[model samples]
Target chain A: MALATLKNVRFAGMATCVPRRILSNINDCPPSLRSERERLVRNIGIETRRICQEWQCLSDLAYDAANRLIDQLGWKKEDIDGLIVVTQSPDYLIPSTAIILQDRLGLEHTTIAYDVNLGCSGYPFGLHLLGSLIATGSVRKGLLVVGDKSATIKDPLFSDAGTVTALEFRENSNPWFFDLNSDGSGFKAIMLPVGGHRNPVKFFHLIPSEDEHGILHLPTDLILDGTAVLSFSTQRVPPAVEKTLAYANKKIDEIDYFLFHQANKMINETIRKKLRLPEERVPSTLKEFGNTSGASIPVTITARLREKLTEGSKQLLLGGFGIGLSWGTAIIKVEEACLPELIEA
Target chain B: MEEFIEKFQEAVDFQDPVEVTENTVLLDLPEWDSLAALGVIVMFDIEYGKTITGDHLLKSKTIKDLFELTVA
Candidate 1:
């Protein structure tokens, strides 16, 4: 059980950026999916999603969001001592995206910058990683930029978006409790089949292939074993939520909101129902943003509960799971965090 | 078995016109896709409190085979 309580770190604010191009799962669905579009939309719970232009990358969105958040928080670029970029859709395989983002954001040379390869679980995991540095007095302030340009091959299942979370060192702040777990055995549940070091990209991998469903995808594209993911998420997330609450000595009712990674409507609803949480407590970005991968939880917060989170203090229980078959839950208080409105690029 | 058939039909959202039975070849159904498989998995989890994997769904030739997997 990778459970810990980090103290003295305050969530300053967060901002999110999505491309201006929108793809409606209903109106923009391909001909192959046209027949079952309504059923797909209803079950998946994503009516529309933002997509990136060809020139855009995950870093571009993240850069915009980080700039906006820094400006909103009134933080100087020189003061940001740590930069953590978490994503599965990085710009390059050579240099870590964080290094590039550090330069792009014009942060000081003393800032610690790197990247963490993760998908849905990236947000909470990134917080734990960066918050540690802040808590230890090694870094006074840090930026956690998490995003994914997951709209590969124009697949409606994934969306493109970036989010930046600012955390500052504060004295006697409320402790943030987290329960994180991972299962490498279930890595195949959600993954790109090829293009990695183990399965190096080849000419054949670049060729588009058709699955039984008649949807065409390259071998390097994300292949989701829906049944496996559904089972893992529905079973694993509920217990993880319970464990986090227990770790924090908090009860379900004490949580003002439960923000889950907007993987899909069906998977999220299953987890919510298993936990017996009311519909209103669990805010979702699935309808507008679809599955924004790592950025989903914060994206949901900025899109749905901006006014509430920006105005008053709220206890939030966040659940993020999938891709690495990894899942984690964090219990934290949003004390008037500067949650800006969603930005369109 | 009759109850299982009805539950399976509902899980897959098959219309009443398309009758399903114990011997019904599930793969033959036009709606039998990854989404339907996910539905059945969720159905088993919610209704029977059983965990069924994609392999179990793929290997089960008929609705009876699927129900038998839940027999335990």
Candidate 2:
């Protein structure tokens, strides 16, 4: 029960930046599965996805997102006292990406910055991290930048984008309720097996096998056990949501929106039905972005709920599940006019 | 139980409309592959209120076998 309720911390606005390159599974589907495109679309609901160019890194997209929000909100760079970039993808192995972005975004040396290596569960967890800090009075205003260019590896299951959320400490701000859970036991369920300390990428790791459906995968490519992942999501997310709502002492109908990680239409829909939520309450970016790893939840916000977020304040219950075999739920309020339009880099 | 056949027909989507029954062997269907098998598990869970595994779907043989797994 990793639950926390924090006050005096609040979100101001968020901006998302995605690469301009769009790839389609219909076009990119491996030769073995060419005819199954329509069926795939119906099940997963991702027709097109954005891909990062070779020159663009995760930090590039995140920096663009963070800088854009800073400019839009008219915040002086020095006023921001903390930065946290959440992503499993990083530009270099040595220097932390968050540290680079602090300088790249022109924040002062006193600002706290670091990276959290998480995938789909990263966004809200990142928010929870920064919000908790802001509530503790150690930092006043902070930038939480989250993104990953996971699509660069030619794997169609992933897309890439970055999102930056601005948070500030204020007296009497709405409280943020959170329940975060992680099962390292399920880490192998969604993972990149090689190119890490456990199994560094060797020359032999590049072997490609074209499946019966024509999709080709390499040894170094991210390995996903779809069956295990699916079963985990179906079983875990409902309870996580229930306990999170219970911790927050809120009912399903009381919340204005029920947003979950845009893992796919199938999984998200299952969780939605399990909770008995109406379709209108759960928004999606899976169709446009096709599983943007850490960026999916926030990307969904900038993509779908721009008007609802901008026109009026809304009480939101957001759940993010997958990769780290992690899942978390948070109850936060979105103030009126806090979300900017989605942008392409 | 009879309507389960029609629902099974919808679940294991075949490119050709192959009539299915309790005794119809699933391996004989054209669309019966790993993807469609996953689809069957998804359908059983969502539509039939039966939580099934990929391995369970793999062990299943006939259309009726899948229906039995749902009820089991």
Top-scoring candidate (TM-score): 1
The DockQ score of candidate 2 comes to: 0.44
Model 1 lDDT per residue over A1-345, tens place: 599999999999999999999888878756766767777777788888889999999999989999999998889999999999999878898699999999889999999999999999988999999999999998899999999998853566889999999999999999999988899999988888788889999888878877756777777777888888898898899888998898899999999999999989778888887798999999988998999999999999999999999889999998889999899889999898998899999
| Candidate 2 docking quality: incorrect, acceptable, medium or high | acceptable
DockQ of every candidate structure: 0.56, 0.44
Could you tell me the lDDT of residue A23 within candidate 2? 90
Alpha-carbon shift of residue A86 in model 2 (angstroms): 0.9
Cα error, candidate 1, residue A287 (Å): 1.2
TM-score of 2: 0.94
C-alpha RMSD between model 1 and the true structure:
1.9
Interface RMSD against the true structure, candidate 1: 1.9
Q: Candidate 2, residues A1-345: lDDT per residue as tens digits?
A: 499988998788999999999998777666556666667677778878998888999889888888888888888998999998888888888688999888888889999988888889887799899998899987899988888888843454689898999999988988899999999998888888898899998988888887766556788877787777877888789988899888888898889988888887778887888778898888887887899887888898898888888888899998888998898889998886467678888
